[model samples]
Target: MTTPNELRLLPWSGSGDKPCYLSTDDPDGYMSRLADSIEAIQLGTASELLEEASEALDSQGTSLDDMRCLVKELTGALRDVYRVAASRGHLLTTSDPREPTY
Candidate 1:
């Protein structure tokens, strides 16, 4: 787990023109970009959860020990969503101006 201080590190660390521009854009467009980034982070987080669950099942036999069928089902679904959303958001971050180029 990331400590609070570790997680407090800002995703954007520099002060510059790109940061200023992203901060000041058409309201609707800015909102859309914000939504996109939020979705991307959510998807990445869900994917990490799925990976953790799969590892637990494979290594610890939680599937048989706990009889928690929902874990298996949810892990699969989350992994699928993670795959699609992460890919789209990653490409967008790389190619779009919504994120500052560093």
Candidate 2:
């Protein structure tokens, strides 16, 4: 069990996924190495999805339903990429002040 003061780094998630924690006391332990592997795999996947999304935009048929679905999946993948960056303490890109968020 993790102490209240300890950080529980949940680099992945869902109702089925379990929380992963590292002992701050041992920075290079087995669990720490495993977490590092998992984070790398996840970030690699994000890169692949980004590539796919770019391809999807460039070579797609003119079907409204398909376009909508592509946009939806791409949006989700981009969100995951941003989340991973944030968890790693990376700064998010600032949005244009004049642009509408919606």
Candidate lDDT scores, in order, read: 0.50, 0.61
Give each model a TM-score. 0.36, 0.55
Q: List the residue pairs that clash in candidate 2.
A: none
Worst 10 residues of 2 by lDDT: 87-96
For candidate 2, the lDDT comes to 0.61
- Return the clash pairs for model 1, or none: none
Best by lDDT: 2
